[model samples]
Target: MRAPSGGNGGNAARLWPGIGGLAALVALWWLATGAGQAEGLAARFAPSATLASAAGLLRHPDLWLHLGVSLRRVLLGLAIALLAGVPLGLLVGGVRAVDAAVSPAFQFLRMISPLSWMPVVVMVLGVGDRPVLFLLAFAGLWPILLNTAAGVRQLDPRWILLARSLAATRAELLMRVVLPGVVGSVLTGLRLSIGIVWIVLVPAEMLGVNAGLGYFILDTRDRLAYSELLATVLVIGLLGFALDTLARWLHRWWVPS
Candidate 1:
């Protein structure tokens, strides 16, 4: 028989480690959940039970509804961040005066965790999707703004000079030169923002929202559905992984290296 190729061997090498790590994790989880021991509270969280619950949940329409709501919130928050961050970042990067005036305040606001604003946001927005959106947008904003600004700052000065020499209009310069050059950085920011938003989303949804994964989690907890809760957690992790993977794929597609 012909020998296996090096590329296939390399693929196996990369794939096996992840599989092994997951197996080890499952083994650890089994032990920690008191598997094969007398029934206890922890036993309810066994990987077997959680995985089974997750499988069942995946087949449920309500779970899909929750997933849809959560995804919609994430998208809206990202849209808000993009709409606000890009222009502000361009201003901060392209103009020294704007940078000087805005950087300190931006830095200050960025340092504050989005969760810290939850109470005030809920008070003002009054416990609905609006507060959740605000928190998510807040969480996602800084990374995008900072990355975009950095991208702009790192842009080649020669390009700007060349554009100016050609008597390019400001709009033309921004649309043709600056925006294209910063696309990679903007995507990077977007990826980072997605991660931040996903992380914050669960808790943000706890702010009296009637739908979404976060609300489902609370419902599971309130109903004493421990296995379902763990399953929901697993679902959240899987979904977050998928989102990050999609973002990375987009980045690669847009910014080939």
Candidate 2:
């Protein structure tokens, strides 16, 4: 028989540690939930029960609708943030006057939590998806704006001078030079923004939206469905992981090491 390849061995080496950690986590969870004991509330939240509940939830069509609605909100909010943040970031980074003027106010607003605006947003937007979108956009905007500005600041002065010497128009300089240089930073900001948005999404969804993962979680709790609630939590984690992975892949693809 052929010997095992080094690549396969290395892959196994990396994979085993993650598997071991998950196994340890499961063991701890089992113990905490009374280790299969038949008569406790904690038993309802045991790993076995949660996994089973997750499986059942996966088989339900309604669950997909909730997932879709939540995902749509995330995408829309991200789009809004990107549209607003990039131009503002470019303006702030490229112009010293703009930076000096707006930086303090931006810092002040950034310090405030997105959730703090929940009541006012709901009052203004009047419930449903609008408030949730606003909250998510607010949460996601800072990272992208900050990172894009940093990218612009770090850009090579020689590149700008070269473009100007070549008689490039302002639009050409921005599109051909500035944008290409900052793509990596923009992507990094997007990754960070996705995480922030996902974290804010749950509570933001509580503001009168009828269908979403957050609403489903509330429904499950109201019905005393502990296992389903846990399952929903797992689903959220998995989805977040997927989003982060996609972001990482984009970064890797665009930015050279």
For each candidate in the order shown, give its overall lDDT on alpha carbons. Answer: 0.93, 0.94
Query: Which ten contiguous residues of candidate 2 have the minimum total lDDT?
Result: 35-44
Per-residue lDDT tens digits for candidate 1, residues 1-257, read: 99777988887989999999989988888888886472766877888788899999999999999999999999999999999999998999889999999999999999999999999998898988999999999999998999999999999999999999999999999999999999899999999999999999999998788999999999999999999999999999999999999999999999977
**RMSD, candidate 1, Å:** 2.9
- Residue-level lDDT tens digits of model 2 in 1-257: 99877988897999999999989988998998888884566878999999999999999998899999999999999999999998898989999999999999999999999999999988899989999999999999999999999999999999999999999999999999999999898999999999999999998887788999999999899999999999999999999999999999999999956
Error of 1 at 77 (Å): 0.4
lDDT of 1 at 108: 97
Candidate 2 runs further than 4 Å off:
1-12
Model 1 stretches with alpha carbons more than 4 Å out: 1-12
Q: Residue 60: error of model 1 in Å?
A: 1.2
Instruction: At residue 210, give the lDDT of candidate 1.
Output: 93
Q: Please report the TM-score between candidate 1 and the true structure.
A: 0.94
**For model 1, what is the error of residue 257's alpha carbon versus the real structure, in angstroms, after optimal superposition?**
2.3
